[model samples]
Target: MLRCSHVLCKVDDIAAVVRDYRDLGFTVEWGSAPGRAHNALLWFGSGPFIEFFELPPVFGLLRHPFGLVHGGPAGERLARWARPGEGWRDLALETDDTDLARARSALRTAGLPVSRVIRGRRTRPDGARVRYQYLASRPAGLPFVVSAYDPPQRPARVVHANGARAVARVRMGVAPADRARYAALVGEDRWLSAVPAATTGVLDVELEGLSGPLDPRKLHGALLAAAREERG
Candidate 1:
């Protein structure tokens, strides 16, 4: 079973993007991973967080060993397909198995178009190290799943000014004709939902916000739209 670990929003300037989300009432943090890229993590208590990546100007022109471009070299191929400006670019899934080889095999057997497993690591300012393995697929807009080889300790709870508690659901927009194809890729996950979109990629996300309901689209950027999901 796969659950959303986080969503990756590609942007040019990390600081500006952070400021935008902060104004929306989310607590965004700055961090970088080795030479990969810089990021801002939008914390929503538990469950999944939103990871925004600030890609380098030479990203597309560079030859990334991993094939696709976002997460690492493996994403080079996928990155080439991404457009400029801020928008949802990648969606990561969490899995129980931590073995990279087994994880790759499982996806292949299940018929997902996944690339070879790629290793990645990052060290926090406090000296904490995060290690994980992931596989990127060219299909379905370069979505990937990763298993933590060494997971980081959970951080303290954050008080959201907008009242968002957790991510309720991620709404991805797909071409009308490719709806079934994308749906099959997403499998049968309850938390992740897909709708026919005029364009393909992440349309919007729903969150459990405190100040009633919220949509990221109403905040800014059409690449990702957000809504508040009611909790029982």
Candidate 2:
């Protein structure tokens, strides 16, 4: 089965996001590059991570045919998925060759629109290369089927001021008709529930361990919170 890979959060400015997340007491790893990276990430040493990215007008790139060649069908879908404004825009599901084969077969067996292998790679600030591939299917709400990273990037530090250890769960929201399918594919839990919502996407994200609330105003109404862990 597929697992929650990462939640894509779109921001107007990458620098502000890195700074804000850092201020929130979480280690933010620059995704694109050190000085001019378009994205940054928050890793808690385990589980899924949160990716913050910016999609500013790329000098008339998307409007040109060469851009389409560069991004391909999957890339076009990603660009279209990320609408204007801030907050959680998209979600991804991690899969290995086994899981990908299973998911690929399942989609074909069910007559779903399956995509060709789409690969992408990026360079880190330190000059290390990060690469991965995935498949996209019909229906905009479906998460991308991403492959496991060979050598996943690590943050300079995983330590956080808050007691947040890892992603407790992601409270996902989907169309009522699509909830069951989503639940079946991604599973349901306190954090990763595919509940019914008017809008289809991530409803909120809950990080494990914390007693107080974060300022929603600063978060741009992204609906992220930290709850005290329930010990049995």
Candidate 3:
């Protein structure tokens, strides 16, 4: 089954962004390879976390033979989208199934774009190894699929001062006209949902915290809006 794994936030400065989140009582860790886009990860217990990264300035200008640039097409697109300011950019879904062929077949049957599963790996500063398979979406705004071969263990740093526990749900804002298209893209998933609103991107995310519900936006404006919406 598809589960909302995390959300990607593109920013202009990693250090500043990390500080902003840290001030909000959330543990942030720097985790980016040299020569690539700078990034930091925020762990939200056992549920979805947030990934913040900054695209290289020259990303859009460079073009590759495969129609990609410095950080590939996704990076280029994110660079453009974040030009206005930092906010929600990408959503990720997780599944236990590691069979790419079967996953592709299922997505294709649902009439969704299915790219060849690509393998990815990264090593943590403490010598932990991480590996996963990624499947890019067609429209680019929808959540991408990530199947982890060796999912990282929930660290002791999962606790937060803000009383936040886990990501409850994600709501995507879309134009009324494109509702059907976006709905089909998301399918009928419980952890993920969409609604017609003034915007056409990630609307808000809900978090289960000790103080009931918390919206990340209240803590940081640049941090995309995240709030709990009744799932009925």
Candidate 4:
């Protein structure tokens, strides 16, 4: 089953997002930009890491190819109508199938359309190169997007923030109709829902943080700042 991947916050400072996550006790990591604006990946504790991406092309590449707007409010909008966690976002699965082609076929037969597969370079701190693949093509404003990754040189955790053991859940605000469809996509039995407009941000996810207590407000502010930086 696919689990939540880190939520994307469309921002204008790739660096500030890193700082914000770092301030929250999460280890934020950076790699050389694939191009254009910077992309920062933050590993909060174990397996779940949020990636902040700048630039429209990069964001579009990761999300739904056929974009649509599903909303809770009229005035709030962001880049190509793909606001934070809005639309059919991606959730990754730890599959026995690492070969992307096999996984894509399975998803297609399951009913989720394969949008596109992205192949790129990821680098480690020591400058080692890692081949990266991201799979997508789910419709917009739906509940979940699915992705699979393979690291050619280093482990996926190496380029991404490490420490998170497993993703617990991701909460986002969406129209009631949209939410229901999404829940169905994720398999209703495993997904949860709340009243429409109950939550504020586009997406909210929980990571199995390290032992001890971590404050949600602190993490929220850091995430906001990073989003702002992406804009500026």
Candidate 5:
């Protein structure tokens, strides 16, 4: 089954952003740490999760080619100007691939671009050895990242806060050109109207009645508080 796994958020402050999700009542799950080289997942009940992937300290938002490719920063022009949170970063889908072959074919048949599969074993702080398969690529500059759950690695189900449910409609604000390409590539007609709003340079994830609109400012405050509580 195809499910929206996580919404990737490229942020300047990982802790702060993470806390925000927790404050909003979502159960926050931290991934392999060391901050810079890792990411965190905020479970939104069942399958849908929101992840915060940090940019290496040595590099700014736009410094990496991958970031730039997905509407992030590029070169040394200072990506901070592009704003802290923006763009329809990436969409991750979950698949159970025992052989890891059939999962690849589905993406090909759908004409979605595919990237090399990365294999690695991650040790959780609790001493759980989790193995994962990461497949990602930009289909026409629109990212389609797929991940298969390896049972022996970690539990397939993630538990978030109670009453945390993903509403049917989630608005992804994007540039007209990019938005059109995304709709065509994903093969979904989620875009309500063809009319594009002014360029905020930041991708806004609009939740129907959850919390109106989400941005870095509100997120930062909430995440910081959660981290402090978690640390204490």
Candidate 6:
């Protein structure tokens, strides 16, 4: 079964985004190195971290190549439809294996839009390398599938100043015709709750914590809230 991996937010400034999120009690990590720095990861240490990134000024000059890959090209499809200031672009559902063919087959049989597999890899800040692959469709705002080629290097748990634990709710605004497809993508993970919309995209994300809602404007249009009780 596939589970929500992580969500992407297109932003213009990594520094500002980090500052804003930290001010809001989150432990935001800059996921890129200097000079070519273009992203930050909102790591909750568990399920679904949030990735806030921006395309290069000269992104048009980049190329998308075939076969196993490293860096920029692989992420080209992710940023293709996103604008710098737009929040909550695509939601990725994940599998434990690197080959997404099985997942793609299921999606297709279920009548969901599934693209050919694309693989990628990158080194983490600690120098650990990670490999992954995913399936995506060209639809403007639909969820996608991703899988790790090897064991994931991300932390299994973390302490958030805000007392966050998990993603409690993802309120999605989806197209009526694609409702079933979206439903078939996830299992009993009730994180996603959908409402019909003129278009398909994330409407809000409710994190499992004890804080109030955030200002969507600061979040580039993603309406996020922390709404879970702290356990003793």
Per-residue lDDT tens digits for candidate 5, residues 34-101, read 35435676654343456676664454544466444432212222233233453245545556653435
The whole-model lDDT of each prediction reads 0.65, 0.69, 0.64, 0.45, 0.47, 0.69
Candidate 6 regions off by >4 Å?
Answer: 56-80, 212-218, 228-232
User: How far in Å is the alpha carbon of 141 misplaced in model 5?
Assistant: 4.3
Say which prediction, candidate 4 or candidate 6, comes out ahead on lDDT: 6
Per residue, candidate 3 scores C-alpha lDDT tens digits across 183-208 of 76666766567876764567666666
Native-referenced Cα lDDT, model 1: 0.65
Best TM-score goes to which candidate?
A: 2
When sorted by TM-score, best at the front, the candidate numbers are 2, 6, 1, 3, 5, 4
Model 6 per-residue lDDT tens digits across residues 1-232? 8877788877777788877877777777767553456778777757777888776545633434421242332344544534445677778778887788888788778776555777767666666676888777545376777896465656656776767667777877889876666667665565677889998888777778745556555675556776534322
User: What does candidate 2's lDDT look like per residue over 1-232, in tens digits?
Assistant: 5778888887888898777767777667888676879888888777788888887645225533633553344555555545568988778888755236667677567665656666677888788888877777545566667877756665545877766777887877788766555655566433466667876678788887753566665675467777435332
- Give a tens-digit lDDT track for model 4, residues 21-104: 566556565656434336666554344456665554434443322223222111112233344431223233333334456655
Cα deviation in Å at residue 104, candidate 3? 1.9
Name model 4 segments beyond 4 Å from true: 33-37, 56-96, 143-148, 152-168, 174-181, 188-202, 207-232
Sorted on lDDT, best first, the list reads: 2, 6, 1, 3, 5, 4
For candidate 4, what is the lDDT?
Answer: 0.45
TM-score of 6: 0.80
Clashing pairs in 3: 205-226, 205-227, 206-227
Better of 2 and 3 by TM-score: 2
Candidate 2: segments with Cα more than 4 A from true spot: 57-76, 98-103, 154-157, 180-184, 187-191, 228-232
